[model samples]
Target chain A: MSAPRAEAVVIGASAGALEALSAILPALPARFPLPVMVVVHIPPDRRSLLAELFQAKCRVIVMEAEDKEPISPGTVYFAPADYHLLIEHDRTLSLSSDEPVLFSRPSIDVLFESAADAYGDALVAIVLTGANDDGAKGMRAVVEAGGRALVQTPESAFASAMPRAAIDLCPVARVMPLAAIAAYLLEV
Target chain B: MNGDPGSEKVEDIEIRLLLEAIYSQYHYDFRSYAMASIKRRLRQAREHLGFPTFSAMQESLLRDPALLPRLLGYLTVQVSEMFRDPSYFRALREKVVPHLRTYPSLKVWVAGCSTGEELYSLAILFREEGLEERTIFYATDINQDALHAAEAGIFGVDRIPLFTENHRKSGGKSSLSDYYQAAYGRVAFDKTLRRNVVFSDHSLVTDAVFGEMQLISCRNVMIYFDRALQDRALGLFRDSLARKGFLGLGAKESLRFSKHADAFADFVREERIYQRRFE
Candidate 1:
């Protein structure tokens, strides 16, 4: 498939997210053009340290996504531990305490589906290393909306279920290794 | 071909008309809510409620009075647990309770107290703090069903374990089992917990402030609203607070950049607890 143009990027990772995201997020240059929203499956009882952990590694701004905050062009927004993060068509962030999807509060499908609606063809959705099949349905939404879907090549992922699911759902998706995934995003 | 590639724009138009129909027919003002969540919910409603389109749903809604409550179940969120945020409750116990105890008689409003989880949490907290007898708790929501469920004060037995753990983490003084009786996979909290509580139908979006409150805990509710609607709710909280009263929000919600920012001073910043500024 031809490389699609991008306006924003949404990524979902679970189980092995820390190592998976570490390979890609920190590689983005300072003040990257598009907003990057991330969902890493986390236990609702504990505080999320992803934003703080990544802030030390990345040049881009990293913080938990807050409700009603307008999407800044260059910042990286991480879904907080318990709320499902979404992007409105108006380009502002929204948080939901509505029922969790598939027992995961910060569900990857929730973010990917909403971001697809907001960005449509201009969105790039990446499904990374995870132990579950959460992001597959969301990948279908992204692909159906004409947005780009990139899955980390399953074998290269620490746990392959998530990316494998996405690839199965959207056969048109581009499958790549961690290093190539980072390079692909940098080009966008 | 006329609409956006995916016809997403058409869906937005359909959704707006549905929300408008809901308001005109039922007097519920969800027109100004955050569209992303509203759209998500409506899609679920349309699929599960057996409507092919939002327009079709609106058509049924305009004609059927009975459909209003069922549709509302979709529009308003109703998921919560007692003492869901342990640190916020811990902050309340350690920091805000002393100030609250200063007031001779306290009025605590649990704004948007869905399904009574937060209300019961506060009721138990006040009782433990030695203030329940002197406090009048107003539990309000726009949804009548949620208000009634909250008044019933029964929760799933499975949820009690989490509630118990959270209570312990929030510096709970008494055994959680002392407050509720578990029977047939459901736990009904002690009826005395509601002795000083008033369950009422109130909307933060449309209802005016009814009483001055010493402490207001409106968590996770404002996240459903757009910025302007949130400003309206925050303004209501500001006006309803007594001087130096406290307002606590959901962990991720904040008063920063709100139109009512100056009306509140940060009392416990990390816990998203704010104090009504004395002006």
Candidate 2:
């Protein structure tokens, strides 16, 4: 297996992602070296409780990155309401009220593209269960940036369209079940 | 009002008529708000008004002055909370307050200050920061009822806990309860907070600049406007601000890609706080 060395992980998931995230985040050990960033599709105006909700489920500290907050390893960051969360040069977060892509701010594509730029070869991009094709382009960006791309196997995902879309767009490294992904990440 | 096939033209014409009537009768221009949001609100008003058609609603609006208030209620989204978006308030306290202290007498405008949550929040912020004595806050909105509600400064007791938490989150130096007195299922904020606040009718859409200001907090209201209207509102903010004055917008709104992007640099870009570029 050509196991690409992964230092940071970016996960893009939509409607059915919480199912996958629940399994993946809790399954990772406390000593995991990589940081995780997630973009969950939601309406722009409402408040997000993803950080608080995930904190109870996972060992890693979960937080919404304030603009310019440094992204640290072993912590997980979720996008805040209505703002696209991007990675700055210093590995900190940058937020923009820029126009929505795929009718979503905090878009999966925005996060994945920025993560690709920041972490390049050491990045691991995951496309989980989602109803739409939002993460496909960004998943390709991850692969093109010399990062590893993984998709939840469609038959195993809660929704298959998103992972299938990514598979179509790029030569995704693996289409693993959600449980296998967590274990694989730990070993690699 | 319900619309069948071939209703788009009638809707447009009716909207223009209602807007023109509002302009001539009320002198409140809502002509430029994004068509979709406005239409949605108007539709809600029609449903509430028991009118079966836009034409019927238009006739009633044209005839009854009181109906305008009901219409305004639906059009103006007054959803607000004290210390809403606590981090933005925290940023203002840390970054903008110091600059405001330099002014001997300060004027701050809370433009589109729906229901005055941001205005009262600012008042509390100013008082705690020791700038209240010299500051005059002009809290303006197009909705008369919302202005009235803001001027009254009463909030539901149920909301106090959340608001207090938000206040603390914004780094309050004192107990949030100290700012308001609980009575009869409501809490009346302290009069001292509003000693310098003047609530009045002002519309960013139709009204010209009234006075130069040291700071303007127009949050959330610009999202309803299209880019042209956003540009116009931004221009108004630019014009109303003193040299090096501050501008704050909603979390989801920005000056980036707007005509005024270069006119102001961010104080805290994440919080959408900016200071006018004087140099």
TM-scores vs. true structure, each candidate: 0.97, 0.64
Q: What is the Cα-based lDDT of residue B176 in candidate 1?
A: 92
lDDT of each: 0.92, 0.82
* Model 2 DockQ (Cα-based): 0.04
Candidate 1 ranges with C-alpha deviation above 4 Å: A1-4, B1-8
Root mean square deviation (Cα) for candidate 2: 12.1
Our tally of clashes for model 1 stands at: 0
**Residue pairs that clash (backbone atoms under 3 angstroms), model 2:** none
Evaluate residue A17 in candidate 2 and report its C-alpha lDDT on the 0 to 100 scale.
75
lDDT of model 2 at position B232: 88
Against the true structure, candidate 2 reaches a TM-score of 0.64
Pairs with backbone N, CA or C atoms under 3 Å apart (clashes), candidate 1: none
Off by over 4 Å in 2: A1-15, A18-188, B1-13
